[model samples]
Target: MPYQIQSYFLEIKKANLQKLRKDIWSDTPVPAILQVGDTRNNIAICYRGSYTREFRKRSYMVKFMEPNTFSDAHVIHLNAEYRDPSLFRNKLSLDFFQDLGVLSPESHHVNLIRNGSLKGVYLQLESVDEIFLKKRGLPLGPIFYAVGNGANFSLYKKGKRKKSLTSGYTKAFGNESDDKYLIELVKQVNNTPLTDFPRIIFKLIDIEKYARWLAGAVCTMNNDGFTHNYALYRNSKTGLFELIPWDYDATWGRKVSGGIMEVDYVPIGGKKTNHLSFLLLQVPEFRTLYRNILEEILETKFTVPYLTNKITSLHQTLRPHILRDPYKKKEIELFDGETEVIFQFIHDRSAYLKKRLKYLKS
Candidate 1:
């Protein structure tokens, strides 16, 4: 008989979190070197998750890291044994998004096995965008901002230790009073540093554009989107914070939902009450920038049917991966109901925004 792996695997939560990392991986291993952030998994790191490394090969460097607090390399709430035909999904997401002209990283699939069977799966991604940034005249992160937008870069220090490394938004705009003793949070603004691209807020129109892109995308293929998950970073010289998306968990499939899951309420713009309008009001130069984004997105709007068709094609391709687990087999069925609700949601949202736009114009 094939070596039967238990449903529960080397999982981690609470105190054993570090131990779980030690269980399957080691700190000394060349791949686990973390570069930034205090939280474990969310921190950017070099991960070697693909085929074993050899000197002759292109080298073992995959950017599998995400900015999550949970530190889970693999997630399972659907009671699934492992992520479904996982390798192919990454490729599907990359190709589809890139083809759609959204900035995305290139990904490769690598078959993974544990205890002599395929128990765990992951993707090997090389951020060609990062490489492109280097090859092009622009520097990776800091220097690009410093030179292009006059933004400042700071090594966030805690006492003697440099705790975090972050770049973007201006330094001169903040004060010590912004740091609160109760919440312990110094209000954060995600943008290019030094340069005031309040206009970056205008890129919110892309949400609708992306919504339209996804309206069909969600219907044809079960998809999920969360706020702040869609990132916009403007190259100061370009005067554009290109709407780049990341963390495509519920993607490239036709998921069936009996009812709206918690993931359905996924809000954009973080815990804000009213997302787009609130953001426009908070940012200083929103009206002028939004006018520009609205014109562009509407001009090149990807229709519902077109998006649905593309996503449906993608879902068909990802069938093997989507059905790898028994639970995932049922999960795809759940998506059918979910998509109808999500579709109507965006429709209402678009009309509401249209009303808002009219009010603003008046």
Candidate 2:
């Protein structure tokens, strides 16, 4: 139902496209216009992501501007979802997170046309900014994006110092002049001993809510969310930090970045270094809580029946457009086959986790 609603148009100058590709990594935005549902507004467009931007079909970050904008949103993201052969990875993951009560960006599939040529299907994600907080009735506190591959929340390696930890995040909203709270939190997380980790985590983060978010990520097998491809926000109301997941095209059994992730793969950073989980798992109570949450998710949201139905419905909705997409890389059969893979993953992953957990408690 999401992809069926409307077709969005992005019109930009031909020269700007060349410039955007030339300096793909730059934060500089090229001026453009975005039209959605009979409403048009001025938008600044920029190529987004580190690895995905280098791909032929690029993702984008769009900032809505001008006095007569269509909506109150200051920014939005267009994910090319190039790595996802299924193309429904982001949509399904975000939807699951929201269903579990995580405050995340709302995603809708869009038929994107650039300069009158069909670009293909894109996922339009609601930006995680002040507007997003207001819409969800969440406190607009400091929001920082865990950008780059180096965005690991570790006490070792890149997170050896406070400056190193904060450097990995790009602060999008709230006070830019001071990052004392963020620095202090990082220091506490890294320097605090394992013995005191569980008690202290309650002060800095909402452990129960965060556990649900973590469960969703682990069940989906999103290797990117823990240390990178996430937005960390400090809630002004609760005064605790929370994580929002991003870039999930690599999930659901297939590695988008050219590696095969097994059903038994550890979700906390996968093969990467993750100090946060390393410390948390050291705490017995936290480990128990996480295991419980994972079990609950497997019985409910991550079940084969639930996910298979969801994937089947989405595949039906998207199949027609995908067949006609000019920028599509794979064949129609591959697109259709991906839904089966998703269904298989749900069953296989749930069974694998159940067996793993039997030994985990001992």
Candidate 3:
């Protein structure tokens, strides 16, 4: 069966479009009309992402006005994915995380049309917010995004004490009072004595859930996911924090700039920058659990044969659209060969992890 790419039409005033382009760094959204099929709604559009803002084909964040939503999402991210030639890494990583029983945003490929002009293929990602939790039958809670390196679960940055404990995070959901929860979590993670760390941390976080998330990041080799490119939600019922993966275009053996990254680039536990993971691994029980999770994932999900089939299927589905895409037509050859690159990455990454399982044991 041929893959169907949903088409989104954006109607924006020429003045607003120029204003948005003039200040690529601004988060302010310009009023626009969006149409999908026969459905139409008012939306606020703005440029999103840090480095990708400079790209000719930039990404966008669309906010649907009240009483008007697209696919039950009040907000959605349209990623140009100009950096990743395959344009499959982010969705692939999110799906893999879901398979491991972790909460992750849903995404699919869609064609975006701006002012009747084809802007090429984009990955439409469901926003992780109150609606996301309600859709999954989960309770709403305080949600914070790790916006920068200061969200390393530490009170310091670059060997100096941080001026604010909440420097790297932006509260996405909840009131001003909810900020204390994240602040307290960071304090406990950094100041808890080694002998009493496990007892204290088990109350703050779900170790198994964190292990699964860590394992997913390790398998995908997402260098930036540990300290950033993720979200934390404190479950109101359980009062424990859980992780939600995000912004993973730089995974699956590729760097953010679309360059080749070695299979063993990131350590099994994760980057040392994250103090939470560091403290968790210090407890033997947590280390064992994390290692076991990685082993199970490697044996089942991360194998080359398993992923090759997935990569091949996605490659076939995207080929026709990719060839016709004006921005991507020049790199048709590179796009066609990306499946093999991803397969080789799976093979080498799995082998490296299998051999390094001993490190986790020690």
> How well does candidate 1 match the true structure in TM-score terms?
0.44
By TM-score rank, best first, the candidates go 3, 2, 1
For model 2, the local distance difference test gives 0.78
lDDT ranking from best to worst?
3, 2, 1
Clashes counted in candidate 3 amount to: 0
| Candidate 2 clashes between residue pairs 3 or more apart in a chain or in different chains | none
Each candidate's number of clashing pairs is 16, 0, 0
Worst window of 10 by summed lDDT in candidate 3: 305-314
Against the true structure, what is each candidate's TM-score? 0.44, 0.93, 0.98
Q: Give the Å shift of residue 306 in candidate 1.
A: 2.5
lDDT by residue for model 2 (13-88), tens: 8899888978889979989998877778888989987878789888899987863344567888889888688888
In model 1, what lDDT does residue 28 have? 31
lDDT of each: 0.33, 0.78, 0.91
What lDDT does candidate 2 reach at residue 225? 72
Candidate 1 vs. truth: CA RMSD?
13.1
What is the per-residue lDDT of model 1 for residues 161-272, given as tens digits with 9 covering 90 to 100?
A: 2232222222211233321210111112333332443443333233434333333232223233322223333343443334444434344332322223333332222223
Compare candidates 1 and 3 on lDDT and give the better one: 3
